[model samples]
Target: MLRRKQHRFQHNREAHNVIERGKELYTTIKGHWQEYFKNDNPLVLELACGKGEYTVGLAENRPDVNLIGVDIKGDRIARGSKRCIEKGLTNAAFLRTSIQYMDEFFEEGSVDEIWLIHPDPQPRDKEEKRRLTNPHFLTEYKKYLKPGGLFILKTDSPFLYEYTLEKLKEFDGYEILDHTNDLYQSPLLKDHFGIETHYEKLWVDKGYTINYIKCRVQ
Candidate 1:
């Protein structure tokens, strides 16, 4: 496992679709991705994009938009980046970086939409600050999202679903577009909600209900 990880890290650095940390350009500007992808398409991000199923899948369907999969795991990034190349997906890229430093790579108001698909819920009360849908993370996201940008959260954790719903209520500049504790049972059968991650499928097979929330950051 260790050897495979090391090899993947090295291989990812050479993949055009993969961007690793310590890249000088990443430290400087946020909108550099436009130049990288060589287009003016709206940017969409899949946070904690393990193996980039959402990023690659969305890019395949939405060629009009550019997609970036952000995750810290180089091994998973290698798989996603490799698939992007094999499929000739120019609009899809993988960024091997922690979500905590997203602001450093994106310009203010640059992002058009964000998909937090099956992110770590940080279920413990003491880890509330680490929850991706919590205030701290939401504040960071708001800084880079354009006005009226959408945030889509999909999870199997009931705690996170309820917690995020309450947080949205207290947040001043955002409004809940829609939410459902049982995604499969909801009327939404397509688009972002229809796109499933590996973890999502596993949860579904285990008889866990998937919860989803869509909010517009004003």
Candidate 2:
């Protein structure tokens, strides 16, 4: 309870910048939208989006896309919201909610692609089902991802990379477009996920390699 109150206080402090990212009121999305100067529009979802650095960076660099950064911590979203509004990022948003409950918000076939960046990689022997690669969550994501939509999983942990690799193999429809242990060694990583995460930067600084995959459900 104490922790919750602290988080709420921090979130309230930055309430002015964060537009509650939930879609429960999408009927008013366009109404409140700050018309971006860009002409093209594509929607992107970033699961487990902590500070939303990736979401905001991508939105700033690519004004042609709309980026939704999802994280459960209202306090963390507050920090991200400050950066977005300060940058005048018209194409980015931050949501305060659990990723497991995401399907309730995004409409079916509405999302263009996804960026699964540095997820917790839940590893409790009995909690394997909670991992993002769990089949149940995959099914939920399928409802939102458009046909041929891309999925990018970027991680510094070999365990998560290999685990997700096996998970994708289990899905007959998924086609692995590209994957590698050290994406910096390959040319495709730049084409897929774009920039790195805060943890990813630390990993690279510590000489840790990045393993990632870009795929699609056929």
Candidate 3:
């Protein structure tokens, strides 16, 4: 398994859809996504995108938008990169980097939307600062997200759902567009809700409610 993982990482390095750390493109691609994607389509990012289920799904469903999946794990990114290549998804790409360094890759106000799908809850009180919706990370996201851009979060952890809500309230310039503790039962369900990540499926099968939030950054 270890060998296969290494092989996938290597394959991702060679794949056109992937930009791994230490590569020249990793740094040069910053603020030049239009050139990389060869289009001026609105850009969307999926952070901590393990396996990139949503990234691939969105690209397949929304051809008018360009999608990039960001994650630190190259082996995991390989799966989504391969799928995009197989399907000839030119508008989809993968970036292997930690979410903390997002600003380094994207220009200020360049992103149309940011998605956090089933992110780590960081349930421990001491780890609250590490949550994706924490004020710290939200500040980072604000750097790249365009004014009035969307920030969406979908998670199975009640702790994360409530924590994110509180953070959004405390943070200025964020308007909550919609939220639901149980998405499947909510009237706010949209077409995109049909795309389920691997983790989402697992939690749903176990009778866990899926929490969703859609907010716009000012």
Candidate 4:
């Protein structure tokens, strides 16, 4: 029993490494994270990356970019990171942390591009602060996105999409390239969903409209 407990304890530690690293990895990598990877790859971030579905898919398709999946849930992080490891992908990384503390991890104008896929809309009035497209979070993203870095947001919520569109007009650091109700009808929707994760495929099956946008951060 003691040996079993010890093994379980070790297991939990490995599972929580993303969370632990999320808290402290940035301070050490402030100006030198790229050195550790030893290559000139574009830094791509998937914010609120549940299960890292998109991150893993993107890394699989594009070997030229370094993909980082960020989420706050341990279970999701474990599943996502484990999948990446199973695929033997060196270009992908996962971090467990809240969006509120993102500035700590990314230096100003460091990220080359960003992806926000299926982020919780938090429709409740009180939870409006939790919306990933809230002006505050946009500001945080702007700080990390390099000049002209691409910011892509894909969701099923029309409310969130319309809200984001209105805000982008007033926001300082973005140029909205495409805003659409159905991604399939648009010629720009290149099957970016690699493994389909779980939700993206489900949404497609249910006939939910998938909205997408590609914004260039100014």
Best-matching candidate per TM-score: 3
Clashes of 2: 0
Q: State the lDDT at 189 in candidate 4.
A: 75
Please write out the lDDT profile of model 1 over residues 157-198, one tens digit for every residue: 898999999998998878899999998988864756357878
Candidate 4 wrongly placed segments (more than 4 Å): 1-12, 15-26, 191-195
Report the Cα lDDT for residue 134, model 2: 76
CA lDDT of each prediction against the hidden true structure? 0.86, 0.75, 0.91, 0.77
- Model 2 C-alpha lDDT per residue in residues 86-135, reported as the tens digit of each score: 78877787767688766555667777888888888787678788888777
Q: On lDDT, who's better, 3 or 4?
A: 3
Please say which candidate is ahead in lDDT: 1 or 4.
1
- Estimate, for each residue in 1-218, the C-alpha lDDT of model 4 and write its tens digit: 66655653344357523434534554665555587456878899998897788888898899888888888765666666777777888888776678787776778888998899988878778997889998988888888999989888888888888888888899986999877878866776774743454777788889887888788987
- TM-score, per-candidate, Cα-based: 0.94, 0.83, 0.97, 0.88
TM-score of 4: 0.88
lDDT order of candidates, top first: 3, 1, 4, 2
Clashing pairs in 1: none
